[model samples]
Target: MRPFLFLGTRAEDLAADGEYDAVLRFSGLAERDLRRVRLERDELPPLDLDDWSGIVLGGGPYNVSDPDDLKSPAQRRAEARLADLAEQVVDADFPFLGACYGIGTLGRLRGGAVDRTFAEPIGAVTVTLTDAGRTDPLTADLPGSFDVFLGHKEAVSALPGGAVLLATAPSCPVQAFRIGTRVYATQFHPELDVDALCTRIEVYRHHGYFEPAAAEAVKAAARTATVTEPTRLLARFVELFARR
Candidate 1:
């Protein structure tokens, strides 16, 4: 079977590694089946969709909506590269799943309004599947409403044009959406668990997702939350898209 590709843009080693591990674990993909590229350190290489089963973009500190002056050179380069890649992925209608930052990339491509208006704090939140979500292959089998971990400074303020709204939350209306049959994005972090969320909360404490002083409290809340449903999306993606 062709391996899946994991693209991440985190600059911090701990957070980056944790994100990869979580995706690997949840997707039930062996290390050899999941090839990871840290976009923070390398440019997105020329991709041939035939070489892989699918692509997964993980969460990161980079916000596509950030002002140009505030973005790092690496962020700028990665964004430009991803912008080009987004076109290809959409044109091919390739299988891709993006969590957190992934929503921005796909959302922007479809002319969705990505902004800070729907930012969610670090914690678990209830996500209700839309009628479309309940019928879509990726999310169809899941409960109508379930808890998921999410913490982002920006989210899709308006639904992307021609994109199906899959999930919605009171804090963020555009919790998840799909473009074409094979492309997906979520405002929440599907790969996170208690430990992963705590690690991110600590690593990004100063990055302003929340009050730095409340980091421990935030972690404590995550520790007690029951979040076990979202990972199914990853497993289902692999199940539905893996090729022989």
Candidate 2:
């Protein structure tokens, strides 16, 4: 079977690897079936969509809506590469699933608004499916409202043209969306479980998702969260697109 590609942007070693492991676990993919790419440490190559079954984008510390003057050199480069790739992916209607940071990237690429208007604090929150979401193959089986791990400084204020809104929350309207029938994006970390959320809370304590003093509280909340439904989306993506 052709392997799926996982593009990640975490610069820290432990956080990066942990994210990869979480993806693999939630997607139910073995190492041999998933090719991981660290966008922080390497440049995106000329991609040929036919070579991989699908693409999965992981969350990162970079906020696409940040001012140009505030963006680090690394963030600039990574964003540029992802912007180019987003065009190709969308034009082809390729199979893609972007989490957190991916939503901001795809939202901006499609000429939609992405800003801090709907920033959510760290921890699990209720995500409710819209009518469209209840019928979409990726979210059809999910409960109408379920808990998901999310913490983002920026969110897709409005979905792009021709995109279908899926899950939503009071704090953030565009919790999930789909472009055409295949490409998907979510403002939450569907790849995270309790342990994974705890790990991220500790690793990103100083990255400004919240006050450092609140890290313990965030981790404690993560430990108690019953976030099983969101992970099913990861498995569903793989099951629907993985090459046989």
Candidate 3:
């Protein structure tokens, strides 16, 4: 079976590795089934879509809404590469799932309005499925309304043209959406479980998701919150796309 590719940009090794592990854990994929490429550490390798079952983009600290002048050289380079790859992925309606930071990539490509308008605080939020979401193969099996872990500095304020809204939270309207039958993106971290969330809380405590002093509080909250439902999305994606 062809492995799925996971693209990530976390500069912190611990956070980066943890994100990949969480994805593999939830997707029910073995190390051989899921390969990773760290965008921050190196250039995006030349990709042949047919060589992999699908692609998954993980979350990161960079915000697509940030001004060009403010972006680091690495951020600029990563965005350029992602934009190019996203064009091909979306055009083909390839099996792709982007969590958190993905909404920005696919959102912008489809002409969605992305900004800081819907910044959600660090914690869990109730995500509701839209009518389309209720029927989408990837999300239909999830509860009509379930708790998801999320914390974003910016979000897609408007749904992209031709995109279908899959899931939404009161604070973040575009919790999840699909560009076509196969391309998908979510504003929340479906890869995150309780332990994974805590790991990030510590690694990114000073990265501004929350007050550094509130690190313990944020972690405590994550430990107490029940955030299990979102992981199903990962499993469903793998089930639908894994090539034999």
Candidate 4:
């Protein structure tokens, strides 16, 4: 199988490897079968859907619904590129899994409203799979409710007509959704665990997920945060999509 294309920004350190590590941790892709393209730092090459098994988009700081003026040229380009790729993915019902920010990018393409009104902060929260989620191919076996790490400032306010609402939480109505047979999105960090979330809480403290001084508390919360079996279903996602 061809290498799965891992698209997203470059995390200076912990994320330096970007979704590569996440994919490794959660998917069937080995280091050799995964190739990462940091859209923030590199000019994305033309895409050929046949070149890989599937596409996996990681989370980022950019919010798609934000004003155009607020988006950097790099972000704009990245979104456009991803949007173009999304159309192809949707057209073929290609295998795809988008985490966190991936929801906004694909959600926007599917005519869903992406906004900050329902944005959730960094930490762990119980995500209840909707009836649709309970029946979804990806989430069918997941518990009705489970704790998963999350850190987003935007959510799907209105789902596109054909999209299935896979998961929801009191904090954010659209925790996860699916556009087609193989395309999926989530507001939670399926790639993250307690130890990983604490790292992000510390890095993003001053950046705003919580009060600057509350980093410790947030870290504590993350430490005790529960990681559900469903979250690791993302690995199964990789096994199906990335290793095809």
RMSD of each: 0.8, 1.0, 0.9, 1.7
Off by over 4 Å in 4: 242-244
**In candidate 2, what are the lDDT values of residues 1-244, reduced to their tens digit?**
8899999999988889999998899889998888998988798899989999999999989999999999988889999999888888899999999999989889986569999999999888999999999999999999999999999999998779889999999989999999988999999998988888888888998999999999998888778888889989889998898775
User: Can you write out model 3's per-residue Cα lDDT over 1-244, one digit (the tens) per residue?
Assistant: 9999999999999999999998999899999889898998789877999999999999999899999999999999999999999899988889999999898888887567889999998899999999999999999999999999989999999888899999987787899999989999999999988888888889998988888999999888878888879998999999999986
Error of 4 at 188 (Å): 0.6
Sort order, lDDT high to low: 1, 3, 2, 4
Error of 4 at 190 (Å): 0.7
Q: What range of 10 consecutive residues in model 1 has the weakest lDDT sum?
A: 103-112
* lDDT against the true structure, each candidate: 0.92, 0.91, 0.91, 0.78
State every prediction's TM-score relative to the real structure: 0.98, 0.97, 0.98, 0.93
Distance from true location, Cα of 68 in model 3, Å: 1.5
Candidate 4 lDDT over 98-179, as tens digits, reads 8887788788865678888897778778889888888877888789999888888788888866898889989898888888
Q: How many residue pairs of model 4 clash at the backbone?
A: 1
Candidate 4 yields a Cα-based lDDT of 0.78
Q: Candidate 1 lDDT, tens digit per residue, 5-92?
A: 9999999999999999999999999989999999989977899999999999998999988999999999999999888888898899
